[model samples]
Target: MGLGCKMISLEPPILCRLPPTTPTSFRTKTIVFSSYAPDKGGGAVSTGLPKAHTYTASFKTLGACKLGISWYPDFEYNAQGGTGAGTGSKVADDANELSVDFDIETLYIPPLTSSTTKFLGLPLPTFLKIDIVPQLFQGNINQESGKVDLEFLAKFCFSVGSVYKAPALLVKTVLTSDESKGKIRGGRGERLDEEGNCKLVGVAFVEPIHDFFMDSFLT
Candidate 1:
């Protein structure tokens, strides 16, 4: 195994380390609709309302390069916004050479539920996103190398109207991509380098996607 054929777990990646700020239209944006809380123009919502929380979660992989874990698989989630998106970055010399030996799983419980405890084993509502940063030739973020090119983007989407007060409607989804890696250094800096090649693993929404507020919103 070498830089050209290393396995790295891929997981949720975020954009603009900030929380959603778009205001929902009271008439249209909001599902159930909420009125002003008396004189309190900014009446707070539920106390359990998550203040846009984020954390790092991790799993194990047998090898970084050369040799890989037999049963564990080479793809190990380094870190993420709770879903193993934090462990760090992975860079490989050969882009198409990296391979793994396992399936993917959700590393965190999204603020939204993946599903409800139903008789049909139905999944709850939830959201998922993944960010990928790759250092092409230069493979360095600190150095100005032309050998590697860094490219990154995040595929994000959330179940619309998942807000506690909102009347969940259609299974709405919004996605966008951005650049996470730029200025290729000698190799991925703080980012790690495994054996053979690396592909930052792959993204998975382990949690099932469901529609809880289908009656009022979907109608």
Candidate 2:
């Protein structure tokens, strides 16, 4: 028996419909980004505020008086209000001035002992000892200029082995990159340099204590 075969056309319909075209204005849009992109020159683009940085330093000071006493202070800058971990903000009016905080507990000063301290090329007596404990350290620094001005507050404890112990002498001063003048002492400081070295100077007045020993010693 012979079978009949049917032919089918694959051409599209003559009335085929096309989707409507979008308006010229609607086809393009302007997008705004909170951050800017780098320029064609390939320069860096600032996204927002600058970030906080931590710094460590060892500060040393030598007296110009007769005793020739010296101090070695080691400290670390937290840059986070001294509360441990976090980023710090900048001053409201100055973007270059960054608020800094320091870890007071980390502040250390070598005791005036025979091994660590000397006086006029002579080793200090073992019986006499002096220690410094930082109470407060907070200030602002110009990141771009490397200028620093920090308010430093510390206590100087004096003791003579088992013989006597003096009350802590409160010392407060503004350690700065500029000059600091007190009633009896004054000095100048230097700004931070490319090697991260800077000199901070401050003069603090030693007030008389009510105790007889302190008054006599200070006088």
The best candidate by lDDT is 2
> What is candidate 1's TM-score against the reference?
0.20
TM-score of each: 0.20, 0.60
Model 2 per-residue lDDT tens digits across residues 1-219: 000000000000000000111000000000111123325476765668543333332222222111111121111111111111112345777867666665666543334456544555666688987665668756766767866666667676888899999888776666566665534344455565544344555555556667797656454
Task: Tell me how far candidate 1 lies from the true structure as C-alpha RMSD in angstroms.
Answer: 22.8
Top candidate on TM-score is: 2
Q: Write the per-residue lDDT of candidate 1 for residues 1-219, one digit (tens) a residue.
A: 011111122112211111111100000000010112223346656666334322122322222211111111122222212221221122345322211111123222223233311112333334422222221111122111212122222222333453444222111111101112212101121122331112221111112225453232212
Model 2 worst lDDT window (10 residues): 7-16
Relative to the unseen true structure, what is the C-alpha lDDT of residue 145 in candidate 1, on a scale of 0 to 100? 21
lDDT score, candidate 2? 0.41
The lDDT of each candidate is: 0.21, 0.41
Error of 2 at 106 (Å): 2.7
The CA lDDT at 149 in model 2 is 67
The TM-score between candidate 2 and the true structure equals 0.60
